[model samples]
Target: MRVVAIVLLGVHLAYAGTHSLKYFYTGVSRGIDFPEFTAVGLVDEGQFMYFDSNTMKAVPKTEWIRQNEGEDYWDREKQKLIGSHQAFKYNIQIAMERFNQSKGVHTVQMMYGCEWDDQTGETNGFRQYGYDGEDFLSLDLREMRWISPVPQGIITVLKWSYNRAELEGRKHYLNTVCIEWLKKYVEYGKSSLKKTVSPQVSLLQKDPSSPVTCHATGFYPSGVTIIWMKNGQEHHEDVDLGELLPNEDGTFQKSSTIRVTPEEWKKNKFSCVVEHQDKTVTEKEIRKNNASDDSSSQRSIFWQWIWHLKLDITVG
Candidate 1:
């Protein structure tokens, strides 16, 4: 939606947060990224801001505020605000507070009045208290600087929807939040990499010297493909890319195996190429003779076993 920009004209007197004053100017300014919707400005009400590295300098918060809201300018002297080189999370909190104070918009209250979606809630897409497409989100303020794409990969906006109650209840919203794309992004790289099948298949074995079967697996949102090879050349016949199995953390895993008895296993180079995006990863395990019948399935499924991970935080 195209947002009609509203120029803020600070509620106070002539010396407001909307323009750069002539007599004052703060050293550093804190503002939001218009493109990404992330705020990154200092907020010293008095315009007297300092930093361990840059010392305290005179800068007006009004002008900084005016930078985005209106045509207000900052004065070089007099007006002052303290240093605002604080953490972004804390800064965002300040932004939210200021927004609520200025506009009489209380997010917590909005959230309270809106329907609950804690069961499968995700801090994704745009808006803080609302859902985007599928209309799971109550609001779709894609026009705001701080509510759209957001910034720094952190959801700075407190999501809320103006018409969240209209998205219907759990039955439909759940499916809305249960986005199909979430199951499409897999955590690849080395941490999630499984090294069960390594190197080339030195040998092959099958009970009746026929075709062999194998499975492919990965974290959720992953795509799997079956790739059969003979003497390092890709073999395309009789391979099936089965329905992907889901991971606990929302990834998809899949496997496909063809029954290859002893004779076929010995002559064929077998592998299941895991596919995600434009990358293709290969894992190999070959048998020299068609008589080796100990299923490789056991080792393949080892990573499926889970252990817990925990972390503790303290707030003083």
Candidate 2:
């Protein structure tokens, strides 16, 4: 999958007890075929709503959200995003000017979100901006101030920080309004968001000299841990963990590879242990690539595993 640099705050909390509501906004310079501006909303790491410059309307991506929300809700969201679209376009131009860039592809992105721990009743929120894949500015909620990482963003920080009332309002929305909506969305889609599905674990090896790959697929909630064990002891060396990727069915998949020579492999017991929710999958044997397996079929299946990771947005 071709992953973008847009960071998602609190998305890793897509676990059993923690829930997150996040938004991502992107603005691009001219010459790109992609949308000039786009927005997306996610709940528990599943996309629920989306809007783009071409569409100019906020549309629900999930059936539950579409069924529960009325026309007025959609209309209100559309109007708000339309305004944001214009603002982002202007912001992108301003950013380009600040960086003294005349042309080429440039992107400005914003990510903000709230996380709630149901078991502990704890809540947290964050807002950050990026320019050309680098951090530009962010909100310091505790101090109620804006912080800029790049020199180009210092002007924006100084100007935005002076607005005390707006800062207070932003803080209130993130801490209060965002949490309320997240709870409502969770209730609306509890059947999907709260459900847990165990993964189908497999141990694959292309050749005798290749590293052993432990693959887990079709897992829900995406909070999974994969580790290598040697002689029943936790092993950390020569392990490479892959990113969690979404499946076509809305579930997730991940892989962890361990490098060990054939001689060492036979000398000790090596195992791959995967833990998701309450289920555990332990595999001690390797499944070698079948001689009859077609490479083209494998390539097709690999492309089928790739999917776009959508961005998200929420009205404060």
Best by TM-score: 2
- Provide the lDDT at 267 for model 2: 94
**What lDDT score is found at residue 157 in candidate 1?**
31
Worst 10 contiguous positions by lDDT, candidate 1: 307-316
lDDT of 2 by residue, 226-306 (tens): 989999999999998976655545666778889999899989999999999878999988887554643422532443322
Q: Which candidate is the best by lDDT?
A: 2
Candidate 1 structure quality by residue, lDDT tens digits, 1-316: 1111111111121121121111111111134222111111111111111112143332223332333332232222212222222332233344444334433221110110111122444322322221111111123323322232333212333432222443244224323342322221111112322322211212233444444544444332233355666677777666654443323222334555565555666566666565554556666764443334433334323322210001000000
How does each model score on lDDT?
A: 0.29, 0.75
Model 2, residue pairs in steric clash: 23-312, 23-313, 24-312, 40-312, 40-313, 41-312, 41-313
Question: How far in Å is the alpha carbon of 87 misplaced in model 1?
Answer: 54
